[model samples]
Target: MYSPALQPLFQSLLSTLADLNLAYDRDREKLSESMKDANLRTRALEKLKQQHHERREPYLQQLAILQDRIQRGWH
Candidate 1:
């Protein structure tokens, strides 16, 4: 049982925790999406490198950027 005065505080804390959970889920989803895209791009770059014997600098750079963004919690 909680006192009346403390009820609001408890409610506010619960709300804050809920919001944090939602934000965490959103960030996780974004990270997953970024990783998937990076994997796809990497695969494509590998294919291009194999088929055309070209450098993969640009794709590698993009993949690095995506990884950095994910690490930095850009979402």
Candidate 2:
């Protein structure tokens, strides 16, 4: 029941609000996707770190043996 002059202004406001809502939803979806990507990267990095530590165990054992030999004057 708005005045004729005010009808266009009300319609314009409604259109603007609808556009803002759509933009907000799109941004929310993008943020969720980004969080998923970050979690995947974090899991990958953790796996690599575990593998690196596992690979170093043998080298460490060798180094310890060499250290013992040097201390005993066997090399």
Candidate 3:
């Protein structure tokens, strides 16, 4: 078994993941607005797309760190 201190850290990471997921969902909704009745402006859509792309690397890095901590006993 791992240290008890790791529990809170794990919880915090889980919370962070949840928040990130919401941010991702919000970005996706903005990207999808064009498909729906709402007209997403080209400039605005491009900006949002760029923002999402920029966030991709950091989010994936965080996910990888969390997964590593999980399988590697919080090393």
Candidate with best lDDT: 3
Instruction: Kindly provide the TM-score of model 1 when superposed on the true structure, using C-alpha atoms.
Output: 0.46
Total clashes in model 2, counting residue pairs 3 or more apart in sequence or in different chains: 0
Q: Candidates' TM-scores?
A: 0.46, 0.48, 0.48
Cα-lDDT of candidate 1? 0.54
C-alpha positional error of residue 35 in candidate 1 after TM-score superposition, expressed in Å: 1.4
Off by over 4 Å in 2: 1-36
For residues 1-75, what per-residue lDDT tens digits would candidate 3 score against the true structure? Answer: 656766776677677667766897787676676555445456666776677667565756776776777688874
Full-model lDDT, candidate 3: 0.68
Which pairs of residues collide in model 1? none
For model 2 the TM-score comes to: 0.48
Which window of ten consecutive residues has the lowest lDDT sum in model 3?
34-43
Sorted by TM-score, highest first, which candidate order results?
2, 3, 1
* Preferred candidate (TM-score higher): 1 or 3: 3
